[model samples]
Target: MHVLVVDDEPALRQILSAAVGRGGYSVDEAAGVVEARAKLARGDVDVALCDIKMPDGSGIDLVRESRAANIDTAFIMVTAFASVETAVEALRAGAFDYIIKPVRNEEVLNRLAQIAALRGLRQENKALRRQVRERSPVYRFGSPGMLEVERLVRKVAPTTGTVLITGESGTGKGVIARLIHELSDRSERPFLSVNCAAIPEQLMESEFFGHTKGAFTGADRGRKGLLLEADGGALFLDEISELPLPMQTKLLNVIEDKGVRPVGSEQVRNVDVRIIVATNRVLPELVKEGRFREDLFFRLSMFQIEIPPLRERQADMRGLIRFLLLVHGNRNGTALDIDPEAEEVLLAYRWPGNVRELENVIQRACILAEDNYITVADLPSAIAAATSPRPVAGTSADAKSHLRDRLRNFEADILASAIEEAGGDRKLAAQALGISLSSLYRKLDEMGHA
Candidate 1:
């Protein structure tokens, strides 16, 4: 990291320069704000450790000037004269942080390390998006349920409304999202996706709206948030129900105004993009519990699409399996054949993890196949054990029990499999089973597993 030290005091300059230099940073020394601005123009500086008391101008003034010119340098003010008012003013003028003089060199070094991590994350995000743009994914679905979904995608592709996709997890929510983007007029533009459940809640808002250099902790430079990066394109926010209530409001405002305001900055940038959001859980139930904002939910679901679970649409399973066979077959550099018995087992089992689990199983079977033929034993133990359920000694379940009782027992089996598939995460199991946590708990207790 290149750290610039701008202090008018010769003694302080020598001390900070040597200490920070030895701390493994490329250090540049500037006597005043004027020299600091000149060094900043060189554009090699990652952070500027500037003193408030400078000969030419206050460090705050330099911060304002550098930011106004878009220098992209993180600024930290170091001053012996520190006050609540001064600190607030420095931050308002866009300094990343303030340190009271009698300064601990350790604090300075720690702050620099944080700035380095932020820069690293920024570069990583950029590289990931670039990689996505270089090559995109293609999804083909032959089931009637998915064909209906494809029709809906075609119908909505020309419109400007927000799309809300609801389904069980791993039912190809991401695939539907990508299809919506690829069929739209913005097909040639950037397509960015953010998994809300995967990101830390504290950083969620900033990741969506972006932030300027020195806007907040560790914000070493400016960044274009996902919404802006998808300008003139599509931004697919998967697991949208996982978004915090506060962020849901912000996202609603962006959808309403077609703009985004970066964190800690007054400027609101207009963006022309389509918003496609997906969630495995039901949003209305969350709103009823006061966990999600109702207004935002209404706005986002303007064009709603509901996807059926894999078991509910078994007709599509064969086509999907064939597609997977081709993909994993090519990946392993061999032609894979599935015997009749293995195919029967696959069709009989309830896929709690949906298509994703199917892909994983296929990949594993491809690796384990002998003579390019996948056998029943090659399947995951959980799936391989579920070959086919036999009736209780020729007794008809319907003849012996009430319809509701039979369904209750049937649902119990599904819950058990989903729980095992999720490795005992009740939350994930609930998502896989298309039920709420409370519902899952109640069912588990009813089944004598509590």
Candidate 2:
């Protein structure tokens, strides 16, 4: 906690500052109401010990002003005489508590302790609410690609390295980001996730680095911003490629310096945040095109993890389908089941939209299911039609072709689709197909596509 000692008398201010410092909190001094207001406007002080009567203005009025401006600092008024009316008036003006003058060190410490306890409770309540909101358990992967991803996550979670997760959209980058935070030493701190593409261009700096009160026309109150909120924890920046070049430079500075200067504030606050950025766009390509800063890209990509698209993780399909069914069923208070044929169709279909698309399909199937059973008919026509098995041709040429020949052609088609889905990265395609890179190359040569 950061405490502000606000009083006109130099001796009293020194006494209060010493008392607060002894309680193990960072202390700042303000000589009068104007100075206190200026310090509080920075939005860093957690508590203010203010004298009720000051030469320039009353602390009661300051409390009312801070409250009206939505500043979160808790005020503890100090009065020379403990009159009932004055105490009541301070409380009414939004002073958290009052301390009689000739303040005992123990009394001041006790009040500070109480305020700290309340703040802790509020933080706990926030954490509890987040836990309640996240109802789905993390899904374990069975595919080789996803297994490698899991290993990377485990390895990086224990360290403080900045992580960059790259993959196609909807490939669970956000999920992996959260998993890293959960597995980290700072799990109890915070895990703030935001989409870079979603933030407005003009407000990017203000939103990421925070701003003081009246920093802009609409910024009536100060903000702690995402970086400060995620101090001592991980911040997941999804769709990070969307950040403008200027913001990218600022982000790079924050990463390198471990400090952030809020909008319109000259003071730079130190922060300890583990940045985890994700993007479907190729950042290196953007750097080459001069759309992204090379320094920022290099900094973020020091430890990169790629999440394979759902089509690449065919081994995880059945488990994912079952998990989604269970999740949606439990959510809607229904006991849902999928027909064998329906499951086969789902397993064969290439989910271009990845896990997110699969979840939507499952949720829709659940809603359209009859007798709590999902069948082939419940699936979308496109998926069902695309994966429907075709009959063998009756032509003489087809019949003359050996079964091995037909199987080889089918395998070639599968390999080609996997390559396309893997964004033409043959190694990734080979990994997805559970084959060696050399074998993938050999197979392509055999099929005359080398």
Candidate 3:
């Protein structure tokens, strides 16, 4: 690992640098915040030891700057006086650890090693989670609201009760259903998912329950249905509400009996498979209107989970964005940064399409971003348009308030436009706007767009 030592005392800096170098790392020395910032700009430093007091600026400023840049560099604050308030402030500013000024070489080395180990574990866990997510056929969620969904998944995954997942189109209801199956004891068994909406009413039964060789016009040969294929595992019925009334009745019987009757076969085939249903529409409303079977609705909704829209949990947007960028970056062999201005625009706009939309946006931005950073101009035109505000009909109390509102909107629009233009290259966009990247990121985070 490469370490940077920032201190006003040249002698102290040399001592710290020598100790860190002896601990198996390259060392860089900085006189103060200005020099530290310059070294950071050059990049590749993994950790920094900064003195609390400096001639130009406090070390807290350096800590804050490092965090804002989204740098993974760990920080250790060194102070002559370790007061409660100073330590608290240093930690709050994002320092990894704090040490007294008369730090022993052994103590410093030990803390550095600990931080390295912890950071390694965190990276490993992240990689493992990413692997699991990618391997799962259906299991997609990167929003805070989905945390509840995950909890419920864990609770019901081991159970035999039927599960009904409800969410908007493209909101990943299918993914949740698959996760439940994968988490269950029958994970090794065959898992099949059928989209009820895609099958025609005439073929729904045959598709789900199978048909005999001479059952229908197209039943020239015997074939196994999804339920039979999913024996000992899970059968996921997506868009369950789209199933016709007759099919719904047949499904209800199959679930209750744990067996299947082929279209023309007299033989009854017993199968033990977990059933999971997902729909975007409300089944209760359908049942009340006599469009769906009430008994079937009751049977399928034994375990119900409602996935909320992305707008409700905007706090997770940044984490999700970061995750997606890493995903795409790994795939394309490129790294990307999110411009603060563009991030603000993203957070401000209500995502009607939810997580799916956010993923799509990020994917596009990744492709479009020419530089290391993703700016607002890289966003889709629709998002840019939505984020830009127009003049309100009502008047404000004062010109300042009116100007403030207008300026806010104007800033949002500029950020959005810049990101769109930069193809979501935040660093490049920040440079274009003539502001420090850290400042841009901070501004965007404050606007809830990061």
Candidate 4:
């Protein structure tokens, strides 16, 4: 932890700094509010210990300024005044804790620990808020397949092994990668992501390793590579299969050596980086076909997670659609409702493009929809095309069979609509459907949709 000590008294500042440093934290000193503000502007201070009365300004003012700037640094006010009124005022002004002057070393350490815990709580709360805001009811799934996948993610996320996530396009691989990072110890560090398929092959190396000034025609200043930028953090290599063979070798070397040598620089810089790779390709086949290196595949696949396709988890469809409706509605600042008949048709249709396709359909439906609720007519031509086929008419036994088949189709259509709206992930789809993963899976199997 980095600590800033702010006090007007030279002796007090030095004594407190030494004590803080001894407590396994780096210390920066500021004699007054002006110096403190300058130090804060540089953006490295994590916790600030300030005197209530400074020569230039009050510590309360500094706390208020820090809060106004949206800095996450924790503040503690140290002063001769220890009255309840003074403490309350400081707390209201954003001081994390109030400490009396002539401070004991043990007391200071205890208060610092409390501040650290509070900071952690605040960070967790922020993360939870972001999750809630970004989340829609659409990703819920009650299938056994989804439960197993969740269990695997929980097991593998905390390990040091490299993870390779594979799935069909738009199957929420990116979300899974983020969940792994969020669950890991490196959650506090930077989580850098690069889509290999998006960047041109020529610029791939430079983008990953960075380039020193004068290294290339356009090079003006030394640039820190993304690998270096993600030092002591995670580097998410999305669509890793898109990388050319030559660049793959270099990336493999970096992963193995735990360092990188920037372009035009002979000096090697060590890095502490965790890699999480995602791809939509069949990597084993690619390796056999000689398109990908077998060694590199082994290095990346220390832990492999294969996300099931939407069709395989059809029971999650209904919840997914509702989730998507809410998401699109919230994003567009409009309210949308889905008719049961339209939703049933949605569940019956197969989502060839997976979750991405579902989101596109919902967005389209929302824009075209004239009423509060979305009807079958509001759905896209492609979705209607896939869902309009009818069963043949027959006799008594056949009639019972046909009726059962029709009911199953209706259920499938509802599930598909939910999944589409939820954005194709089972967990969110299940939540939107208000069912468990096991029940969703059972429904899918019964309908021959899984």
Candidate 5:
């Protein structure tokens, strides 16, 4: 906690500031009411140990003005008068605790400790409420690129290293960030995820570094920004390239110094948070264009992981489709199935929107499906057009042959995709496809590929 010792007496101010500093808290001193008010107005002072009577003005008056301004600093009024009226006036003026003249260092330390505990509890409560939100299951990857990304995540999760994940939009960068947080020693701590592009440029600093109540217009109450709120945890900053130049410098400072000074505040507060940033845009290119800082890019790229787009990982497509189907089925309380033709269309699409688009497509299909069955007509027009021609309903022998050929070809593709995902290991492929080894071999043999 940061403490401000306010008193006109030079000796008392020095003595208290030294004592508070020795007690392991950052301490600043102000002489008289004007100086104290100036220091307090900054909103950095956590607790102000102020003298009741000063040459310029009364501490009670200062406290009343601070309260009216909504500055949330805790005030501990000190006075030599020791009268009930003085104590009552201090408390009414928003003083946290009162101290008589000739203060004992021990008593002051105790009061400060109490205030620290109260602050901890308030922060804890906020974190707890945030933790109550449900988390979705993280999908495991089968492609070599994703496997390597997973390996990096595991290797760095146990440490305090900052992570920079580069991927296309909707490619699950946020999911990777959460996986690292959940695997880390600080998993129990809060994990905050914020989209840099979503926040207004004007509010970026205040949102990231917190602000004192009344620090700006509409700031009715104090806020402990994302860094403080994610203390001892992880903060995922998605679309990091959207951060303004000024905020970028502040973020780099937090990375190097592990501290943040709130807007309108003069003092810095220590924070311990593991930052994980993600961006689709090439940061180095931005630096070349004079849009991003080179120093910040270097710092963030110290440990980087790039996620491959979904189109480049065809082997994982079938697995992802099945997983999404199962998830949506469980959520909507419906047993959903997709037609082979529809599944073929999905597998063939370029998926320009990546995993996020695939998920949306699946969800929409599930909702549109009749009798819990998703067919080609249920899919989006662009996706449905990606596949080969579908068989027409007919009783002719040629039509029967064409339909059988199409179904056989679809099955072969599914098996090939699964085998590819398993790295040509048939046993693993069979297990992934939930089929027996004998059945897999028999099918492969019948397909004349063995």
Candidate 6:
């Protein structure tokens, strides 16, 4: 691994460079942020040790800038006891790690060693994905819900318009995202996905926008963020509603302007990439509750597609099972068979976690099956308890809950159709529905929408 040591103090810079060299890594030293930026622009450095305070500017600024520039280098901030608060700020801006000074050789060496090992695995995964991007996945495509999903994918995938896929978790949102990318003119380019909820709030901005080297505390190298990486193809932002309010504004600016400036960099780069985002949450409700941006919601919803939950499309279960079985079987080096009783149990279960949960169950069953046949014994406890061929008649309490769910779906569909017919004029929709505008507003509120 190549490492950069940036500190105003020449003695500390020399000490750190020698220590990293002894650890069997090439090392470079930068006296300040300006010198660090020059080294980072080359993009070969893998990690950097940056001081929080420097002559040119604060290290925090450098960290933010490096990430904005899309340099994939990791940064370790070197801070004094009095600068702990500033160190905290740097951590929020995307410093990989921070050390309190006077920095010791052992601590710095150990941290770099761990980062190098983890970075190796990350790079391997990226390379593997790139090598196989041409071999697209094949879907069984039997369920009406899934068929509609496929149809919608093909319908919108060919266009470069932004898309927002809304569905319950595990309904194959990622699969659909990839399908969109594959069908587009930019298919041969790159497809990148970022899970908004999975990233730390502090680092979200730097992750999306490339940063310049020495922009902040630990930023010793420049970075090209996800936006630039997906320049010629599609970028999927899953769980996008989880993005913080401040970042939401920045994202909206990018979507509207088609230009991005890295976290601390003054340069704006025009990018050409399709945006496909997904979320399981009810965004309208979130907007009403003041958690999501309303204008941004409208921008992303230009081509919206919602994938139905697994329970709603049980008709496709058989084909899904057969395909998943063959897949897991080949993977496990076994030809697996499911007994009639086991199939009954799978059919009866609600599958609250959708296709993803089903895949896990099937993989587990494949491992647990005896003599190549999977039985109820191999199923999860909840699913195993469900064996009746008929839908188990529920009690009065359950009936009310079930009826309420159906009514809600029915109402939402009616409202949506009416609004669409009126060309999205809610007042006209209300008149067409033979209801007062106030009544329509009340219904919308009750239905958890604006």
Identify the leading candidate in terms of TM-score: 2
**Prediction RMSDs, each to the true structure:** 16.4, 12.3, 28.3, 13.4, 11.3, 19.8
Order the numbered candidates by lDDT, best leading.
Answer: 5, 2, 6, 1, 4, 3
lDDT of 3 by residue, 1-450 (tens): 457899999999999999988886667789999988866644345689999999999899888987886665788999998799999999999988999969899999999889766754554454346446555233345556788889999999999899999988767787788788779887656567778889988887888877655577865555557776566667889888888988888888888987677677554566677999998898889988999999999998888999887777766777777777887645457678887867766877778887788888988988766556776656775786676443455664333243234545677888778878889999988888876687678668746799
lDDT tens digits by residue: candidate 4, 397-442: 5544432355556678989998889888877887887766765775
Query: Could you tell which candidate, 3 or 6, scores higher by lDDT?
Result: 6
Which of the predicted structures, 2 or 5, would earn the higher lDDT when compared with the native?
Answer: 5
| Winning model by lDDT | 5
lDDT of 4 at 5: 94
| Model 2 TM-score, 2 decimals | 0.75
Question: Number of clashing pairs, model 1?
Answer: 0
lDDT of 6 by residue, 230-278 (tens): 6656789999989999999998998898877776665466666799999
In candidate 5, what are the lDDT values of residues 1-450, reduced to their tens digit?
A: 778999999999999999998987778889999998877776667899999999999999999999988787999999999999999999998999999989999999999999987876676566567655645667788989899999999999999989999999999998899899889998877788899999999999999998875789987666778997787778999999999999999999999998888877767777889999999999989999999999999989889999999999988899999899998755457678888777887887788899999999999988766667776646766665454454557656545453335655667898899999999999999899776677678667766766
lDDT by residue (38-58, candidate 2, tens digit) is 888877677899999989999
Which is the better candidate, 4 or 5, if ranked by TM-score? 5
Lowest-lDDT window of 10 residues in candidate 4? 396-405
Instruction: Give the distance in Å from residue 371's predicted Cα in candidate 1 to where it truly belongs.
Output: 1.8
Instruction: For residue 72, give model 1's deviation from the true position in Å.
Output: 7.1
- Candidate 2 residue 435 Cα shift, in angstroms, is 44
TM-score for each of the candidates? 0.60, 0.75, 0.57, 0.59, 0.71, 0.60
User: 1 or 3, which is superior by lDDT?
Assistant: 1
> Model 4: runs farther than 4 Å from truth?
1-138, 331-334, 388-450
